[model samples]
Target: MYELKTKETDDSVIEFIERVENLKKREDAYRLLDIFTETTGHEAKMWGPSIIGFGSYHYVYKTGHEGEAPLVGFSPRKAKISLYFATGDPEREQLLESFGKHTSGKACVYINKVLDIDVEVLKDLIRQSVTFLQELYPKEQR
Candidate 1:
């Protein structure tokens, strides 16, 4: 059996943000924490040692792999801030067109800082991911 390495932990999100060596990244982490909290209407939680996450969902793939993951999250990394959103959603791609300067991976959108992207677009991404995941895995079922 494969283990999920990024399970949510009872770590202090503020302490994690405070430990960020870069002053700018540290400030942006606080900004992102507020944005994610207000947008998702859920308190932020630490995923693994790094990720600041909000609102979790249970996912089960057809291959029988299943686990809980944040509906949306972000990590203020050394290189760039990584935004986590639901993959395989066409609407996400559509919204990203106006999301300002950023790069995308399989599941993460990387931006240098919060100022580098549109906050409204980021909120949209958060809401869309939360809705998509909630619908996919209804609360009762989870």
Candidate 2:
């Protein structure tokens, strides 16, 4: 069986943010914590050693691999802040057009800071990601 390395842990989300060595990144982490919490209406949780996640959902792949994952989350890494969202949400591409400065991968969006993006658009992305994941892996199925 394959183990999920980034499962939720009983770590302190605040302490993790406080420990971010970069002052700017630390401040951005705090701002993101507030924004994600307010938008998701869910408290933050430590996901593995780094990620600060909100609500969670269980996902089972077609291959029978399954795991729990946060509906949305972010990590203030050394290079940039990585925002986690649903990978298959079509609206994500559309919204990112107006999202200010950011780069993205299949499942994560990278931003330097909150001030560089439109916060309203950020909120929309957060809501869409949560809705997308929740619908894909419905709570009743979890």
| Model 1 spans with C-alpha error above 4 angstroms | none
In lDDT terms, which candidate is top?
A: 2
Per-candidate Cα RMSD to the true structure, in Å, reads 0.8, 0.6
Which digits, one per residue and each the tens of the lDDT, describe model 2 over residues 11-82?
999999999999999999999999999999999999999999999999999999999999999999999999
Which of the numbered candidates is closest to the native, going by highest TM-score? 2
Predicted candidate 1 versus true structure: per-residue lDDT over 53-120, tens digit per residue: 99899888999899999999999999999999999889999999999999999999999989989999
Q: Distance from true position, residue 13, model 2, in Å?
A: 0.4
